[model samples]
Target: MRKKTTIEILLFSLIICMVLSAVEGSVPILPLDQVKAGMKGKGRSVFQGNRIEEFDVEIIGVLKNVEPKKSIILARLKGGILEEAGVISGMSGSPVYVDGKLIGAVAYSLGTFVKEPIAGITPIGEMMSISEKRKKGPVFSPQVPVKKHLTLDELFMLNKDFFLSKAVFHSEGRALKPLSIPLVFSGFSSYAFEQSRSFFSNLGFNP
Candidate 1:
């Protein structure tokens, strides 16, 4: 009886390990070092409401050292509404996969009024590193006291580091900024809405 129970325990542990391994194998990561120019992939995002859609992606090349110890994968996206919309807002953080291996997320695009669907991908490794750091501790700990009511100027001063930090990349004389997301407001008077819109616009939001 003892031997039978021990065998059952070992079998259960083995099954759990096998299940975990299979799950991990399903989504394999394509390291940045292996990515190259002209490689093709597919990106997934929600172009419309709730439903996820896929678009074709072709690697333009890699921009090495775009930031300190960081890199960005330059790719041209096609298909779906990408041709008509040209990398729509809120499409950032969309996953791109190459050869069934996860590569990166769509994060940056050329400024408004451009035609092509060119985008910059933030690599999976760097994203994972940031995620791990987040699990360890808070990424941003403000020095300001949270219990106190603050004016708009005081609030801005307290979080100025976060608000002022914008990562801009240049390509062919065009600046690449994070995709602009539309801001919708409700339950506000016209004057209040206008003031709020102007405030967000100054902070680089589409309002």
Candidate 2:
């Protein structure tokens, strides 16, 4: 009787841990229906110097990307509300939530120094799709017991400093001698760089 009770208690404890693990590993991507054009919301952006800043943003519009329509929200730092922040140099991956539902994350800048100061808001769900390795399958391999693997977010963050260095070069273009600065002096936002690469390539720019 004592052995049976101990086993039962252990089994119940295991069940609770499994449930919590599933919830912890899962990421919430905003449902398509929950997002729309011109939605107003609050957003959080991580900037240079490892600082996080929050702001108010308005959804400018949605662009259809093959299948998923992407949400593009424009934001102004709380301090610069009226003039427009133009999605500062290092705010990519900012999370935008509307009425408590996360709608999208800051993906890239639409253009440079535009008067209206708009930034491209990439739906978190859409960006998530890029990081997804497989379709219609369990996220883990059954053959091998699951151990903590690098998450898309974690991997990207680890490479963040490298990305920022690239951004510095792109800003100055010709005058900015790539060799003039140490590798540590520059950076690139993955979101912005990828966006530019895609946009230019689509227009027939050379590789």
Candidate closest to the true structure, highest lDDT:
1
What are the per-residue Cα lDDT tens digits for candidate 1 across 25-54? Answer: 457899999999999999999888999999
The global C-alpha lDDT for each of the candidates, from Candidate 1 onward, is 0.69, 0.44
RMSD of each: 14.1, 14.9
> Residue 83 lDDT in model 1?
88
What TM-score do all the candidates reach, one by one? 0.68, 0.46
TM-score of 2: 0.46
Q: Tens-digit lDDT track for model 2 on 19-137?
A: 23432335555665566666777777554456776677776555454222433334333434324554454454456778876666555554555434455555555544433422333
lDDT of 1 at 76: 96
**What's the distance in Å from true for residue 73, model 2?**
5.7
Q: Model 2 scores what on Cα lDDT? A: 0.44
